[model samples]
Target: MFNTVLVANRGEIAVRVIRSLRALGIRSVAVYSDADADARHVREADTAVRLGPAEAAKSYLSIPAIVAAAKETGAQAVHPGYGFLAENTAFARACAEAGLVFIGPPPEAIDKMGDKIRAKATVSAAGVPVVPGASDVDIPEGGFAEAAAKVGYPLLLKPSAGGGGKGMRLVHQESELDAAVESARREAKSSFGDDTLLMERFVTTPRHIEIQVLADTHGTVLHLGERECSLQRRHQKIIEEAPSVLLDEATRAKMGAAAAEAARSVGYVGAGTVEFIMSAHNPDEFFFMEMNTRLQVEHPVTEMVTGLDLVSWQVRVAAGEPLGLTQEDVRLDGHAVEARVYAEDPARGFIPTGGTVLAVHEPSGDGVRVDSWMSVGAVVGSNYDPMLAKVIAHGPDRASALQKLDRALADTALLGLGTNIDFLRGLLADEDVRAGKLDTELVDRRLSELISSEVPAGFFVAAAMDRLISLQPTGTVVDPWDIPSGWRLSGPGGITFRLRTGENQAVVRVEGTPSDASVQVDDAEPVRVSARREGDLLEVRRANGVERYRCADGPQRTVWLAREGKSFAFADQEFTLSSRGEAAGAGPVKSPMPGTVLVVKAAEGDVVSAGTPLLVVEAMKMEHTVTAPIDGVVTELSVRVGQQVALDETLAVVSAAEEKQ
Candidate 1:
């Protein structure tokens, strides 16, 4: 076994690899960028190296820097823990040349399967069922239309060298093909550095299912069943589960056999994934999509259900050890489900959010596992992916696992910035989601219903009230150790607390004495709260639940409250509360959540009708244009381009117009 290994990735996966290395008695070396000096993964490594700046293109993707770090640390092997340069064929080959094993498939396999078009051709030739698509070489503007003629309308134009829905588009009309091609090519070039894309006959409603395959240096390959990743948005997976509710015993046997054959055809080694699109409407007809040459983000669900550690196995295989487990030995124990928690807001068009994580408390239970890299007061930079953590749960059956997952998601609490937390919770309760009638287009098809539905305002008010009570000077919230509070009366039973999001302002009514206050937003119900030190960490809860409602900071107070992934913070609004009924409530257009103030669509003098986009706020990797609430004359516009905003912060002001008779 290798004495030491270098992890060539960051965040939760880095921590995951280190844990595995420690269990195997191997020293782990972690590499970090300037933004990651204090990152949890770096802190946990046995030894660490500084790579470069926070920009991934300059730091994480720097192969020479990583190789040098490995040499400096005397690591016998390098583990590309997915993402970054995980599938970079050059990186694998260079590692080999440097006398260090790469803990994944060989460089040859990467090169062969890295290109989607070629991989499909190779696998199809090996008797695997591949989707009917035009090769990248034959994907000219004119050729695309021709291919669609043969392949049929509703064809998919996908980048030959990308994943996660980037640089891909589905065309339903021939007139839209030209523009879609140009746009997809542009995005593909920016993301993958290769503009090559292929065409495929698009399945109307297909389940995004893929089989995990493992290969050994000893010529043995095995498939580890399928994972359902059908529920997605823009090709990015939101919900994933193993032991798919759709597959049957006979279908599993055939898909597994085909997956194994595909691996063998390419002389595959180590771990890889064979992606397929199953027509849920017609399960008998499935087609190959692409192959991932590294560990996928959804690997945890597979891990829990299969009772295996893919990372550990990768290391063992790279060390020239054969895969000890055979197909028959691969037993599917139960069901597993996962939800990715991201630092992006759903209402604001899901744009990536940037802020310091003020507080974080992960969910814990019998079958729940949270893979994360954040603690308290971690600065979230715009240079990286905003995914904060992954929450997974496993059980003997799908229903039990789902119930566990719902509790797990509801239990996770965070403060600092807006997230899609509430959105994910809504997905769990969605009728279609609960029934397993998911497909690649499901997120798009039901985008409105999912985003607009959730717990009532009482929850937000309750959460806000919880934050208020935890902030008292005498009865203050403390870390871990026990601490008491002194009761003191101040100016008013309620004090004025103000929070600014862009140009919008949220005037909240916090009803209580100086010691404790009940938060009432608009006309929402209030929740009880108390905060004091118990042992090592400060604990606060909304009412009396296992979950903790809290905030943490570096120097300044950074606060966060989780609403699914769309948690909100009101640090700028920390003032004494007063009766809201007396103060003249200002007509403020507050930011609905934390996001980027993208565009000020309306000017100060412009009179607009209801539904007119006053300005656009982009959040959680999506774009949303905030519109006018009613027909009114714009009195004052208070925001600009490229501004960071919090929930319920004002955007602009408008005077209501007289009714048209």
Candidate 2:
């Protein structure tokens, strides 16, 4: 066992690895970038070191800096936690050259599986059925069209050197082949520094299933069943589960054997996973997608369902250990589901959200666990992936696990950032998702309908009422402006507040004393509310739910607290009232979420009809287009190409057009 292990990553995964190391009596060291100075992972480690700036290239991805940190901290081993330099063959070899153990497979395994084209060839050579595609490694640009045609029109162009849906494109017809290739090449270059691509048959309505394999240096390898990663958005997984609900005993056995074969063929050691694209209609039939030579991001689900800690096994295997349990000894119990909570918005193209975390109150209950790397004041930086946390729930069966997940999400409270908590709560109750009849493209098709699903109106009403009840200065007595001598005013006297947080805003009016208040969001309706200030706490109710807020001597701030599942936020000076006192919200057009604009779909003086795409914004690994509100000329364009914009900053303004014939 290593006396000290250095983690070469950041965020939740690093924290997760550290916890497992502590369990095995190993000291842990953490390295951080400028943006991650205050991150939870840094604070949790036994020792820490600086890596550099917020950009990954200058910090986490810097091989020399990480090696130096490990050596300086007296770390005997380096654990690349799933990303960054985890599968970089050069990094693994360099660690060994520096006389530090790399707690994963040998560099040979990494080199074999690092390239998608080579991985497919190797797995197929090992008798595993890989997806049929071109054998060419680097086909010329002009030759790409011919190869894609040979593979059939509806095919996929994927990067040659890695996975994660990066640099991947689908073309349905021959006419679209060249364009998809160009885009794929650009994306490949930007993401992995490699523009080489290969064509493959596109899997339709596929379910991503992976087998977790653990091997030791003593020539022992074992499989831990399968995980269903079918629920995805833009090729990124949102939800993953173990012991795939659709897999029968026979199919499970076959896939497990195949996964084991792949591992043994490569002489794989430590924790690894073999990913496959299974058909939704027939889960038994699957094709080899790729093999990951390091710990996977979605490994926690398998851990929860299998009653095993993969990280512990990885450490044990790397230390010249043997597999204690045989394949027959492995048993998977109750169903487990993991929902990846991200600092993103589902309503507007799932763009990344970066802001100060004002407050957090996570839910605690049976069969629920949360893995996060955020604190109340931590900033969601642009230096890494925007995942907030991974919430996992285990139950006796699928239905029970799902129900527990819903309850857990309901109790989660994270304030001061735009997250998908509310969106997740609604998804758990969705009929198609509950029935398990979904595919990779499900979210894309059902996104609008899912966001439009009604959130508990009471939660919103209570939040508004709480703001009205708690926004008073200290040592101020009520009823000072009464007309009669020391008289109390008759009827309810309310004050309206315009509260805006990015693209979403609220207009709230509250009146009367803290004991009894009337709250209204708009003139259309008025809600009778009761507020009570007990000591330093204030609780108000205008509807079915009650909101509690703590008052402090500071500028006007709205503290948004949600139960565990719903994403919430709080703001102080950034949320300012408009000139006319209306909320600082805009019209039908929406701006990017702190992202760089790639293309302006509509230009100034360009006459456009309603619903025309106005601009295209790329942020946080996804692309979204803003559209025209009504038929009108693109007037007063304030933004140009290659410009960055905040969440609600007006990118453009449109003039209402004359009626069309």
Candidate 3:
């Protein structure tokens, strides 16, 4: 094993690699940007090196700087833990030139598989099935329409050198083709510095299955089985599991053998994933999608079933050790499921959210594991991906594992920002999902059903009780009359407090003192309830049962109450919450999340209708269009292209036609 290894990544992946290195008694070095100075990964490493600014280009993606950091820290090996420069052939070659071992496939393998266009051609020539797609050559003037004639409509335009769903778009019609191609190319150039693209026939109903392969210097390659990654949103995998229920024993062996053959064809080494899109309607047929040349984000699911330490093996193989296991030796034991916990709102198109993490409680049990770097007071910004952690569950059978995963998701709680936990819970509870009838479009097809709009009655009750409990005095009170809530003789019939979430508001009434109160939540029958604070927990007693809520109160009267695996935030009206999105008519269009303005589609005084694109803002490595909410005229344009804007900052202002009149 190497004496020291540098983790060329950030956030949870860095922490994960550092943990593995520590287990091997190998010193770990972590590299961070300014945004991650106090990050958990930095704190966990034996030594840390500072990259440049928070921008990924100047920091994590800067190959030269990472190589220099490795050399300076005396790291003998560099582990590119997915994302950033993980699949960059140049980075791997640069590390080799710097005399540092790159803990991944050789540069030749990366060059062949990293480029989607080349990977398809090479794999197809090697007798592996691939998706039908046009190459990365420049499109002729009428080439798109011609290409559509052969490949058919509903094709996918993807950046040849991109992953994680960046710079990819699906076009359903000829009218959408041009714009999709232009946008895909632009995002490709911005993200990967390559404007090259490949057009592929988009699979309508496919199950995304990836085979985890490990190779060594001695050309020993083995497949550790398949993971079902069909639960996706915006082409990004959200839920993944090992030993997919779709594949039979014979089909599993065939797919695994094909994946291993693809690896051997590219002379692959270390940890890599061979991704395939299988027809849900026809489980026997499969097509190669792409190969990720590094450790995957959802590798823990494979780990749980195979009982293999993939990271340690990555290190061992990089140190020129042969893989001890052969094809016959590999076995899949229990079923494992993993859900990605992201800082995003499922109801709002899964747009990235950023804020301080007030509190976090991860699920724990015999079959559950949470891989995370989130901590109280940790700042989640839009500089990178919104994924915060991954919660995984394993059991002897698929049904037991599915149930365990559902329970695990319900037990996990994170506060202080919007998340997709509730959305994931809905997925786990879906009839089709529980039945193992899954495909890539499962979430998107029933997005409305999966998204939650109904707020629980318990949420309001918890909020009202938290407000009353917060009014209690912190110091010792000698007399009962000294308690907070202004207990009076006969005046003040009820203490009314207003609470709002988005457009919904409730006027809660508490008829008695803080300790004992009759709470009427928005004209519902008054319930006799008692509120008491026991340390960080709030106990609320009602007619039927007593509910305990985990509450965290931050400065400015912001309270987060968590119960039954879901968290709700309540702020005292005195401290108004600013709107991060569009306001009412004629108001300013604010930047929803902190990001750089990518394009200004509308100029000042331009007349536009509702849903017309006003500008594009890139954040969390995704582009979101800010459109005109009402038919109006653009009046104030405050931001320029490439300008960095803060959350809720005015990007532009549109005056409604009626308001202007």
Which residue runs of candidate 1 sit more than 4 Å off their true CA positions?
Answer: 140-142, 453-548, 551-559, 563-566, 571-661
Query: Who wins the TM-score comparison?
Result: 3
TM-score (C-alpha, index-matched) for candidate 2: 0.88
Q: Residues 1-661, candidate 1: write the lDDT tens digits.
A: 9999999999999999999999999999999999999999999999999999976777998999999999999999999987778988999999999999989888888888999978988998998998887865865755667777788888988888867677678889889788688767866775667889888888878888899999999989999999999988667898899989899999998999998899998889888889999888999888888899888999998889889998889889989998888899998999999999887766555666667776777889899999999887677765566788999999999889998998888778766666677788888888888888888887777778777533345334433444455554354564522211222365344544555332234556666632354565555455555444332233444545534334343234434444433444435544445555431332567776566676678898787877777886655333456777767777778889888777567889765654211
Top model number, lDDT: 3
Over 1-661, each residue of candidate 2 has an lDDT whose tens digit, in order, gives: 7899999998899999999999999999999999888789999999999999987789988999999999999999999997689989989988999999999999998888888888888889988888878734656635767777778867878888766776677789989777677667766775667888888887888888899999999888899999988888767788888778778899999999999998887789999999988779877689998899999888988998888999998988888888788999999999998888898878766778877877665666889988888687888844467788888899989899999988887766666776887788777777988888778888877888778433344444555555654555456565565411123357655666565443455666666655566666555476777776554345666458776653222125655545435544434323544556322222336576776676777777777877777876655444556778767766667888878777767887666544211
Ranking by TM-score: 3, 2, 1
lDDT of 2 at 108: 91
Residue 436 local lDDT, model 1: 86
Query: Worst 10-residue stretch by lDDT in candidate 2?
Result: 479-488
TM-scores of all candidate predictions against the true structure: 0.81, 0.88, 0.96
Model 3 per-residue lDDT tens digits across residues 217-293: 99798999999999999889999999999999999999999999999999999999999998899988999999999
Q: Model 2, which residues run further than 4 Å from truth?
A: 135-138, 453-460, 476-492, 499-507, 532-539, 542-556, 561-564, 567-591, 597-618, 621-645, 649-661
Q: What is the lDDT of residue 161 in candidate 2?
A: 75
